[model samples]
Target: MKETELRYVLALLRVQGIGDIFAKKLIQHCGGAEAVFTADAAILHRIDGIGEIAIQRLKAPAVLEKADAELEYIRKHNIKVLYYQDDDYPERLKHCIDGPVLLFTAGKISFPEQKIISIVGTRQVTPYGTEFCKKLIADLAPLNPVIVSGFAYGVDIVAHQAAMEHQLQTIGVLAHGLNQTYPPAHRKYCPKMEENGGFVTEFWSSSNPDKENFVKRNRIVAGMSEATIVIESAGKGGSLITAGMANDYNRDVFAVPGRVTDKYSQGCNNLIKTQKANVLTDAADLVYMLNWDLAAEKCKPVQKQLFVALEEEEEKVYQYLNSKGKEVIDRIALECNLPIYKVASLLLKMELKGVIRPLPGKLFEAV
Candidate 1:
């Protein structure tokens, strides 16, 4: 795109109350960002949502100055400005109505025939969540999928590190601009991250990591990916919001089921229960859902449930475990109306029988 056109697009962005959606609409109706300013009354009248106030704001001198400053920063820092209409822009996001008109990115990024998935969850990720994230990335490494995450902490940083370890391209979609990292502690990873796939945001250098910006950022993470896998979440958080946006976008969504009693697992459990997400145990579930070539990528086959006979008491415990996804022996005993000792003995037998496996934190799940 022309330098002049980008300046106009950036100016459109600086207009108060003119977000990505309205900005894109204005640009579309006017033929280009530059054309929007010079558009006559007839041109503006034909645009559905344009009003007199919007036209006046479009002519504001301060907006152009701010855009020029941002454009200068882009040129000075060698930042790649991805226009929504351009080939370098994310294809998945282009289909989204509220996708950014211009995305400022800094990275060795390319999306040529790639599989992209966004892994998101609470910043206070548990050990179980960390293990599941690392394992998921490791298993998906064979397919060379691009890992996308918020880069905040916990599951995000873990996913990025695991992807880097596997030498797969990973992008940290930022809530702030590329001028600075939000968590400052994550600054060290920036250089290494840009080497593979780096940071991206719609905000200019003038923007900071405000609270609302994070929510807005979630849409990009959810929009660009073929699917969004929530590793873990509480009853409320940004990850669940991302899953909602992905659902709104009609993209496949998956959630790793956690024990019903676990605090961090509540959001995922609810998503699964409400049928917002498919049950995701492994990368195989994703590959199967996305219809990625099974032969081309070597993902471990999903294990089919074993048809095993059980005593009445054992069957009750087994059903409880299966229903909860994962459960501790105590929870099982209490829920199934069995004594703790009896449940422990049954679990031992179940483990020996290769029907269930024990997890860290005394959790057990049907195999």
Candidate 2:
């Protein structure tokens, strides 16, 4: 949390071709980035991956200026910076192979001892996929677990929204800087998240939301979370990257099953069939697998109520609401493949019973 430490760390990270792994090695060998900067070239080269080019880059005035700019930006925004050695640095992420040497954060950060789950999927999620995400988040909320996601469209947006609705802390690992939210459409929700959870990034404020950054961001999300839940993904999607990273991090990976024909579900189904991920039918399976006692206690009683009163259709709707969080009537109908009028009437009845609450814009939250 020291400003000096943050400045030095950002300087080291700015060195060309010196990524998290190399940066960590440099830090460990030299004691810190400050030491690395002042260390002899011969000693710097002795560290793994610290070749002459990287060493030369570290010594460049331009590189120093960039690092100083990053530090200034952090100061301007009052961003909380955590070096890997800091106690507040996420232990789970630290254990990962390529964890960041420095993290830039905004808003409150909660490092829960409970299970952490990363929900990920395609940005263009299907209606069914969105519904599933909402329900899953609602079910997991009472356990007070930390939810992690990329804050992209589709499943990611739904997961964050659901967590917010339930007053649960959620972290969005950005591919860009904390200076701006990607896709601009997410600006409104970003402030909401700042008030409750937080935003985290490895990139400096001036860094662009480049393609490679997202791939790198996936590792942080997977590394920090105890498990990764892929709500709906295509064969080639960023969610797969997070799932792969989770596997690499030796964390449990779960995927919701969808109809075989569902393009969004194909990646999830493929992951299960390939034994890359466990097939999750509902929140219970996830909770059991994680050995989440807190979530189990809250879920068991609700399971009974869910089973006793819910008809097949109502159960499906409820489950959708629970997973996807609050959703519009049109979306629910499209997801459930039911008539809009029928879905609306059912939602009204559920709303009256305190099972869900209707929000503005026809959005409904599971109560």
Candidate 3:
């Protein structure tokens, strides 16, 4: 957004009583952020949920002063601002009712039809969790997913490092402003992450990484992604909060299942028991659940080979594919009397075994 328009929007948000949802309503009703302040009190009073107090707050001069100061900080630091109504805003987040009206971003961040997933868990990550988190990113590397995390220690940092190791774009969503890093130690990763992906936050330059800010920040981590994956968590933690937000947003959630006795596994187990998330064993579960276009971006299947062994279901799928010559996934599922998800998993396994190959438009054929 231009400086003049950004100043008005910032001022509108600076008003005490106006939240994101109401700010959006006000902007739409008044035609623009500048119009919201310039429109008559009588005009503003006509809109539903716009009380007299809010109208008066919009007229306050101090809000504009604050906005001007913030605008200066933005200009001085060269920060990129994403307006909610603009085409450049995070598309998934735009659907959220509480998404920020303006997002301050740093680094080379772009979201254009990319598969994004958030990996979150307890800050006190264990060896098992670390192993699973790293392997998951590495396995999914072939599809080139954007790995997003809070940029904290443990699972968050582990996910970021793994994504970098694989040379995939990785984003760190900050709970505080772009002016500083929270943990301080993570400052090292910022430069490298900015080269491909970068940091995002709704907080202003003056805002600090307070306790309450994290709870609010969880929504962004969940909102911007296609799915949220919990690598490991205790019975209660911030990861669960993000997972709940993901569920509320109607986005997919996945949890790595571990032993019932494991301390960090308790939260994931509970999530699965309550049917809040799918069981994520590996990348195949994600590929199946999201129904990603495997043919377009998936890892290449092994070269065709003879005498490859197949499981019972795999053999069944192979026979059907061989007889049909080529068939779409849904038709294969219907003919085989298997669930679509099961069929998808089986096809992936067959592809790995050199028995089948995936074609465009979800078509599959025996090799």
TM-score of each: 0.80, 0.80, 0.90
What's the lDDT of the predicted structure labeled candidate 1?
0.86
lDDT of 1 at 185: 94
At residue 201, give the lDDT of candidate 3. Answer: 95
Best by TM-score: 3
lDDT of 2 by residue, 223-321 (tens): 998999998988888899889989988999999989998888899999999999998866756754665543233322232234347567777888999
Collision pairs in model 3: none
Worst 10 residues of 2 by lDDT: 295-304
Candidate 3 per-residue C-alpha lDDT over 169-196 given as tens digits, one digit per residue, 9 for 90 to 100 = 8889998999999899999988998986
The runs of at least 3 residues in candidate 2 whose Cα sits more than 4 Å from the true structure, single-residue gaps closed, are 295-367
Model 3's TM-score against the true structure: 0.90
lDDT, residue 311, candidate 1: 79
- Backbone clashes (count) for model 2: 10
Candidate 1, which segments miss by more than 4 Å at Cα?
A: 297-367
TM-score of 2: 0.80
lDDT ranking of the models: 3, 1, 2
Better of 1 and 3 by lDDT: 3
